[model samples]
Target: MAKELLKGNEAIAEAAIRSGLEAYFGYPITPQTELLEWLSRRMPELGRTFLQAESELAAINMVYGAACTGARVMTSSSSPGISLMMEGISYIAGTEIPVVLVDVMRGGPGLGNIAPAQGDYNQIVHGGGHGDFHPIVLAPASVQESIDLTVEAFDLADKYRAIVVVLIDGSIGQMMEPAELPPMQPIQKRNQEWAVTGAKDRERRILSSIYIDPEDEEVINFRLLERWNEIEANELRYKEYFMEDAELVVIGFGTAGRVALSAVRAARSEGIPVGLLRPITVSPFPYARIKEQTELACGMLVVEMNSGQMLQDVLAAVGGKIPVEFYGRMGGVVPLPDEILAEIRRLCYEPVAPSANPRISWMNRMNITKN
Candidate 1:
């Protein structure tokens, strides 16, 4: 297939259609609004379902209803919009319903800018809703990867019978790039015995998140934990660059990861030994790979588009064995490649005052976040 230029949001919508997306329920939000708009026209033409709900909450609940009927359903929104859907997401997770959610994140604690930011890391990856559940979060660094991962998100959501989140920053969502769309996948029939489509000649199916008995709730939690463990073991995914014999490793994800990789190459060209590790699956988090790769390096640098959200995860993975520094630009500002390269060089050569704790000292000098 010939590659066509497309905006990140358009690419994602096209990919979802090809992947047999049976239904989409979403509210218009900046950076992600294009995704909904594109699908609105295309989905109906293809005889699929698309609805613009009155609110993000309503949209997510619609997705919940569609998913219960064994439909491949999805929803898209930005930061505050996604926040509105948390209650519904928790219900979807608890019910073990298969669905996909696209979070084209923008800045903010509340109604932040419509610019690119990875500030939603904690909210999406750490279970924003009230429960002990984790969604399979996929962070795509480029437009092409966004399309490919959208398809994978649907497949994994169905395979695990759980919610999957395609977490992309605004930079990736609104930016245009050349992409080859995936082949059309055969539409999967939704006439499953588990579906609550109408109890005709079969046992009535009940899909409920509520567990009346405390023990039943505990049992549900246990089963979810087991499934999460299996996903962690089998679904951990990441990418490595120039790690064969490196003195420093840079860690990032989403758009920040793409920028960090460019910086790594620029530093390498200048004879500085630096590498990069990007977590493709943010929830499972590639902690084992991070530890293994950074163990031999002098230190690690975590570049992000937020105030060190993923930095905490990097710190946990390294266990303070080696110095881990952080640099980020919050509230929609993105850090430049030169800035990341400078930090990488400073961590490698600069000598600074020592602190009571090595981790503190490591972050004190390099951890800079722009407001």
Candidate 2:
């Protein structure tokens, strides 16, 4: 009830418990190890299930099993670990099981480092696993947001009978900040007639992704897309910061979005008409909202900790209506506010050679030296 200081991972784990999580199966990994560690003690004290699986694969399957029992379940890991769970995630989606997954992203196409990075954007949002399924991805920018989204992930998962991902970067997972914990939710088990509780009073309900007939599989795929359309139409979310009378809009999500806000404020003080557009829901991204801003602004700059993952999404959103540029910091390095501000200046005020890449690299060694 009272405000207290907590690390982002700890806050998220507590939020999951308060959100009526019945079971959590996770392996310890940097940036997200605290989440598993915290629950290891807390879950037993609360008489709920907590497990340290032999590997990420084992953990996700355990979550699959628990979710099939109509229980609110969760699991967490960092980048490489998450990759290992992709197969199970696909199976979970194929069966239409509701479960929450937390990804405190770190660097890499491989084991890059323990520092924060946003490289998982494509892998998480654009179907990391096989099949034409989409997971609801919520990117939180603060410790409080990490907690808030963790709570929301559970509700959304159950509401749609689909996987929900609470995506935060390594910085948020490792940093400490003040947060107000939500009130403890009363524990309640979900009622799914199809849950695999051994046949007792009712007839046995079958649950499987195997629709052997191609026609049956086609029907199920269409149904899934129909549901996705509903989510895309209804769940698009974003927050605008000082967009009125702005000529340039800076777009980012998760930790990068938070940094972009700082750059926006700095740009405005110098009379550069700049603002920020932060996406809250990464998947079913706010395309319509971004298109509206593109009409009003001269150009847009996309900021991220990856090469150009979300940049492509922004480009698609604008559809060549205005010039779009990109600035990034990869391999666990976070772009400084000034680095972002410099790029905004280039887009709004400075002139550059037309032959240059449309996407600018603001963090080059020369620029870093100047700064």
Candidate 3:
């Protein structure tokens, strides 16, 4: 493996290339526009079909059509653009076609802004469209993870006959870092026993989630639930540091998770007893492992770029066995190590609990502004 300096978006594009993605379809959106442009320029050199979709909706729908033909296809967009693709994503989900969608998130609710944000966590993990299905959402914190997960998403999606999403943000997508490229592999379509390439050559294969009978609907749900259970059992991935015998544990994901690790080191140096839990698989959520860790820790502090999405998961995981607290900066505000360390100090030194009188003093505001 040879290391090369690469931006996160470039790494993802290269990974798709090396993974032998059959086609690329996407519209330009901030934080991820370079991703599509990279494919547009590079795919042709390798004689792969790359389409600059007129809109996000069209891009995702084109992915849907290509996926029906059993092609390894992908599309990318930011938050608002992803919202536009939700209906089509629903269609893709119902059709149960394998595709990869990359979300380079930006501040949202509207035109928002071109900046790093993880506010899309809930929407991506919980199924944005109207349906009872979940997309396998992968959150990558670094260039290397982005490359590895991008390639892995295809394999996972193909195996499950479902969609795999690489949920990243501007910071990771745009940030330059060192990555080692994996050797390219030929992407021949596998399992004609299930693919719909040509019926004349084999039995007809239907790629869809539409079930009419009530019993069959239940059967489909059961099959999907079983697959999800397997996902929970084996696909969950996370990282922990300095957690043994710690009094307080900091939980976060993506770039926020990286900064929280630094804060854990700083708090440890200050004798504030701290550790970190960085979640890599946001979908499987690593709830059981988080619950086990909460058994020993005094408290769990969830740090996130969003208001408190991951915090709720932490609370549910711990089930009040330990005190759960939250600290966040929303709408693209990425918290720093010092800011996270301050929260750790409060959790370590202060006796604030869910029952403790909430300290809503004006001093807190002054301190935050001053800091």
Report the lDDT of model 1 for residue 225.
Answer: 93
Question: What do the candidate models score in CA lDDT, each in turn?
Answer: 0.89, 0.90, 0.84
Q: What is the per-residue lDDT of model 2 for residues 250-285, given as tens digits with 9 covering 90 to 100?
A: 999988999999999999999999989999999989
- Over the stretch 1-371, how does candidate 1's per-residue lDDT look in tens digits? 98999899989999999999989999999989999999999999988899999999999999999999998889999999999999999999989889999999998979988999999999999966999999999999999999999999998998888889999989899999999999998788857666788888888889999999999999999999999999999999998899888889999999999999889999999999888988999998988988886658878888899878888898788887777777787899988899899888887797433222434553565544311
- Per-residue lDDT of candidate 3, residues 235-312 (tens digit): 888888898878788899889999898899999999887888889889989889888987688888888888677777
User: Regarding lDDT, does 1 or 3 come out ahead?
Assistant: 1
Q: What TM value does model 3 have?
A: 0.94
Give RMSD (Å) of candidate 2 vs. truth: 2.0
Q: Clashes per prediction?
A: 0, 0, 0
Q: Cα deviation of 35 in candidate 2 (Å)?
A: 0.5
Task: Give lDDT for model 3.
Answer: 0.84
Deviation in angstroms for 193 in model 3?
2.7
Question: Which residue pairs in candidate 1 collide?
Answer: none
Candidate 2 lands at a TM-score of 0.96
The regions of model 2 sitting more than 4 angstroms off are: 351-357, 360-371
Model 1 misplaced stretches (Cα beyond 4 Å): 351-371
